[model samples]
Target: MRTVRIWAEHSPFDLKDELKKRGYRWSSGDEGRPKGWYVDIDEALEADEVRYLSEHIYRRDVDLFTQIITPFERYSVRA
Candidate 1:
């Protein structure tokens, strides 16, 4: 199995409430995770996730990471 994690890096303070309402949890940067809002979902949900995320996230605030091994590799999308 693989892990697909989508992140909202440097997310605007304005969106925090909506993000929480939408199921994104805030990370305090503990356990080597970035400080921001993120959601862990299966890869199958990527399109749906992107659609929802795109509603609140702009290009500069997005940071996507997939875990295949140590030190997560970064990926990008138009969100």
Candidate 2:
């Protein structure tokens, strides 16, 4: 499985909806941040597709990290 880290200026709820439309699942994570979100993708999905959607379609700013680690020090992904 592959994971991607994405940052968004929109609320989490809105971002989740946008992600769903793109065929990505919103794994639950830190909810306090107003503009941060994360999602997991199957390894089979094309990396370029993920980048394009995250960069253009979703239009939410994101950091592409190979690891599944969260970018923020204080924020933790909720189980």
Q: How many backbone clashes does every candidate have?
A: 0, 0
For this target, which candidate reaches the highest lDDT against the unseen true structure? 1
| Candidate 1, 1-79: lDDT as tens digits | 4546777767678878988887889889986778888876677787677776666565343435543322234443323
RMSD to native for every prediction?
A: 8.6, 6.9
lDDT against the true structure, each candidate? 0.68, 0.50
Q: Which regions of candidate 2 deviate over 4 angstroms?
A: 1-16, 23-35, 58-63, 66-79
Per-residue lDDT for 1-79 in model 2, tens only? 4444443334346456666675554434445533344444445554765567567655664545333433363265557
Model 1, position 62, has a per-residue lDDT of: 42
Clashing pairs in 1: none
